[model samples]
Target: MFDVCIIGGGIAGLMLAHCLPSSLSIAVLTKEDSFSSNTALAQGGIAASIGPGDHPTSHATDTLFASAGHADAERVKLLTTEGLAIIESLLSRGLPFDANQAGLPLLGREAAHSTKRILHAGGDQTGKMFLQYFLAVTDDHVKRLPYNSVLELVLRDGQCVGVCVEDGQGNRSIIQDHHIVLATGGIGQLYSQTSNSSVATGDGLSLAFHAGAVLEDLEFVQFHPTVLTLNGKSHGLISEAVRGEGAWLVNADGQRIMTGVHPLMELAPRDIVARAIEWHWQQKGPVFLDARKIQQFKSKFPSIFTNCHNLHINPGQDLIPVRPGAHFHMGGVQTDEWGATTVPRLYAIGEVASTGVHGANRLASNSLLEGLVFAKRLASKLLSIGFNFKEKEIHLAEVTKEFALPANLQVRMTKLVGILREVDKLQKFNTDFPLRWFDLQHYSSLHIKDIHRYTACSLIAKAALLRDESRGAHYRRDTPETSEQWTGKTVELSLAGYTFGERLLKYKESMS
Candidate 1:
């Protein structure tokens, strides 16, 4: 038995380990190595109001504006306000944020940001730097179980008591712990073309759903505009900071794609930019990032420079091939201010938990900040509520069928539920690719993974089908305009089905 069992090794989980005192025994588990997470691939850096002339209020305003009025105002305020202190604390603990010659933190601007307040380290390797820092500083005694996949959340009497995990060599074991934290990252891998890490298969989201936790805004999937395209698939991500430095999106005729689209043009929120790129792709041929204007791209963005080098595309001359791809999920398991979910003792942080900071769309660079800030808050909350375990008999749900997820699920999801969404397509997807809670309770790890993928895709489709309006990342072509009635309303899903707002009513009844 352990005091806390964190089912991830990303920034949130590792940061929590760093924050917790050494007195408590903790276990951090991940399906792969500790560094293989969305945190390790992030390039745009963490957002905070630490730059000169930048304020938390301004940051909060930009965040809310980008969220399309769907974000919780109080929670957004907390994220921005508390985020500053967290960033500062990281700096105090020897985080080497990039600095100017004057020894001030060098701030970079990203899409939808009012000013330059994004902090990076090791050039474009902000997430990698953060992961290294967290790993180095995390408590030495914290047990790390890499290559251990969490198959199911063991529940007893409506409360999560433990987990059933599978090791790399097909070995399975049940571990009972007092508190469970899911920092299992995003649901990007559900789409065929995505910029997320391989482990982002919605494991945490599916686990929460089957364990009776509420999931909100499943439709709000953020498709980043500037993913590097290779052989008609998403190969890698080109950081938003590259465009922040004046790279323009151009079409076959060398015309600027984002011209007059929005006042910010290429710097508009991710959803708008991605839509613009996709529109260009449909009307014209291939789209490219014209980065010929940016000075010294090699030194400033070393990773991007290397990627371009490997592709044999010179940043100074050639147009870098690009397109929009699944990047982030604004919606996730619903959590309170203290990172506590509806299910008792099952806390969540990072991209897995919807703390309402991102609302309908997440502002670029806020992801890392949200993870750190919420992890800190959760640590404080956990410390206050000391550890005590009352042993309960774990009841594993009966498996109904050994479901093998369809291979074409990713391609189908991308087609029906990608950048553009509509009622007919969503309904078709729901009908053809149905997912039941019963199929999720399986003994095989591979089967469980497949169930998670299908369940997560189903959740997103159902939520998107229900919300008949264009807002933030969820743009329904049929309902191109944002509706006033849909204001403050969110589509929430669980094991029973889906519904809207503060109601346990059936989805059909809520829609009516």
Candidate 2:
């Protein structure tokens, strides 16, 4: 038995492995090759309060503002305050953050932030740099099981003892461990047009939900404002950092977008910007990014420059056609400050865990910071509370229900539950899905992946249907205003059903 089995090879899981005690046997598992994650594709820099003339209070305030009334003030404050260490740690690890001649990291301004507090490495490849640095350091020590998909979390008595993994060759096996950390990335792959990597299929979210963990705010899906449109589908992301460098949004009719959407205009938070772009696209035609005015844009944003060059669009002259696409989920398996879930010995970090840092919507570039900080916190917490495993007997349960996931399942979800949602469509899907899904589950070709898709989609639909107000990333055309009653609240999904729960209840209370 391994000491810990980490079910992701992304930044969060790998970072945790580096912090783990040397005596412990660590196994890092992933369905794809190691380093395939949202982290690899995250072009925008990570946000921290470690720049010139910046304070944690100011950063925290901006996070709260971007959250649109759903962020936990105390948690945001903590995240920003603790973010100082994240930058420091990166620097200590020899991360080559872009710096000025004075030897200070050059900070860029992002949406909702009052100060220039975003740090980039190798220009716009901040997340990729972080992943490369950490993965290199951690892989040497940890046992990595690449291309093994975790199908189920094995439960005995009340604690999560291990996971059931399906190999690439269609073989299955069980690996028992004392602790399990799910750093599995976002749920963006649930939609057709998304910024997430194909590997991000909500495996962690669905598995945790089925294993009786509390999942909160699955409805708050963040649609990024400016994804590159390749033949009407989202081919890639145009990092928000580009807008930070003075690019503006405009429509087909040469109308500037975000003029009246908010005071910050083009620099408005992702949710506001995405809503504006989507609304304009629905009403008018395609929206484009006007980066012509920015000085030396290609050198500064080489990645986006290459992307635009390949697409035959010149940022210097031509308007880059952009659209809203599924980018991030602000909610998932709810975890407390220590990254512990409602279930025993099961912890979730990264995008899979709703740690109350990003409530209704994530602040710009905070995703990487959240995952890094929480991964270290989880490792520390586990070390403090040493493992005491009284291994219980686990049985391989028989699979009765069997059905193949329909090819059109993703298409239906993308249509009905895309960026903009409404009660009429949500209600219809909620009512019709269960009966149809029930039949699909009992078919001969039912697979574990199909169950995961059904579970993730169902939970998101249920949560979105219950929340009748428009807030942050979860916008509803029917109720276009944020609700005051749902302030500082989170809708939790459990095996029993969905209901309201206080955010970050005591650790003992969570298991109760």
Candidate 3:
């Protein structure tokens, strides 16, 4: 038995472990190598008020504006206020941020921000640098169980007791603990194309929902505007910072089209940019980013330049093919300011927890900042609660039995609720492959537990269908206009007490 069992090994989980008291026994269960995560693949920098002419208030304003009316004011204030200190704490722990010639902090600009306040490292590889420092500093107090995938959350008397994880050899074991934190990343892999890593299968959110935690904002997925479209799959992401550096969004005829759409043009917020690109795609054939005209474009964005070269497409001479891809999820397992869910003895942080900071759409580069700030908050909360490592009697067979999701359901989920969602396709998806409410009673294998992907996808589809207007990433081609009242969040759950639409209305009313 350990004091805390973290279900993921991403930056949030790692930073949480790093911030905790060394006396506590913390065990981290990672599905793959600790280094492999969406955090590690993050090319853009962390948004914070670290440079001159930048302040958390401006950052807060940018975040709130980008969220499109669904952002939690209190949470946004807290996160933005704590942003600088979070960066300082990471830096003190040996994480390096690139500095300018005047010995001041260097900053980069993304699409939504009013100021260039994003702190980066080694140019575009900020996430990689952050992870490298985190892994290096983590001491023996933190135990890593790599290749262990959490199969179920162990619950006793309506409280989270621990987690049951499966090893590489297919052996399952329960690590009973007084507290558990689920930091598993986003669910982008559920879509046909995304910028998220393969491990981002919505495991943490799915486990939390199945374990009776309320999930919010499942419908508010963020579709990034500039993913490199290649060989029937959109893989590479041309960072929003490209526009910040003067790159223009152009169409098939090499025409600058965004000027006719939004006044901000390429510098408009992510949702606007993505929708504009999608609309342009419908009007023309393909949308691309013209980076050739910018001086030192290839030198400044070396990573993107090299990646484009690998694909045999030179951004300096040719237009880089781009499309909208599922990039981030603003909605997740609902959490308070301290990253505590409604469930006692359970906590969530990073992208897994919907802390109300990123409501409908996440501001560019704010995700990394959110993870850093909230992980620290959660660590402080856990430390205050004190650690308890005494082993408790648990009904292993029964606990494991209650968790189940079928395999076929997973494939069906990916098909139905992917990047481009529509009402007819969603209804057909539900009719063809209904959610397995009955099969959840028995002890399920990994293949079976994966069907929660269907549960999650179904929720996203239903919520998307329910919202009659397009707002942020929850776009409906049928109802293409953004409505005044539709600016709030859309929530869904598997529990019978609340219908999906009712839950959304309740959340909206609560916010009001």
For TM-score, the strongest prediction is 1
User: TM-score of every model?
Assistant: 0.92, 0.90, 0.87
> What tens digits encode model 2's per-residue C-alpha lDDT throughout 296-327?
98888887888899989899998988988888
Question: What's every prediction's RMSD, in angstroms?
Answer: 4.9, 4.2, 4.2
Task: Report the Cα lDDT for candidate 1.
Answer: 0.86
Residues 1-512, candidate 1: write the lDDT tens digits.
88999999998999898889999999999999988999999877899999877888889888888888888877887888899988887788789889889767889887688999999998778999998888887776799999999988888788888888889898777889889999999988998778999999999988998899999988899998888988766778898878889999998777998888999888876778898998787678789999999999998788788888998999999999998889999999999999999999899999999888887888889999999999989999998988876877665555556666677999899889989887899999999887568534554677888888888898889889899999888999899999988988888898777778742111111110
Model 3 ranges with Cα > 4 A deviation:
243-268, 279-286, 290-297, 388-390, 395-422, 433-446, 482-494, 497-512
Ordered list by TM-score, greatest first: 1, 2, 3
- Clashing residue pair totals per candidate (backbone < 3 A): 0, 2, 5
Between 1 and 3, whose TM-score is larger?
1
| lDDT value for model 3 | 0.77
Candidate 2 has its poorest 10 consecutive residues by lDDT at 503-512
Candidate 1 runs further than 4 Å off: 101-103, 244-248, 253-269, 292-296, 393-400, 439-441, 502-512
Model 3 misses residue 110 by how many Å? 2.0
lDDT (Cα, 0-100) at 441 in candidate 3: 29
lDDT computed for candidate 2: 0.81
CA lDDT, every model vs. true structure: 0.86, 0.81, 0.77
Query: Which pairs of residues have clashing backbones in candidate 1?
Result: none
| Model 1 weakest 10-residue run by lDDT | 503-512
Better of 2 and 3 by lDDT: 2
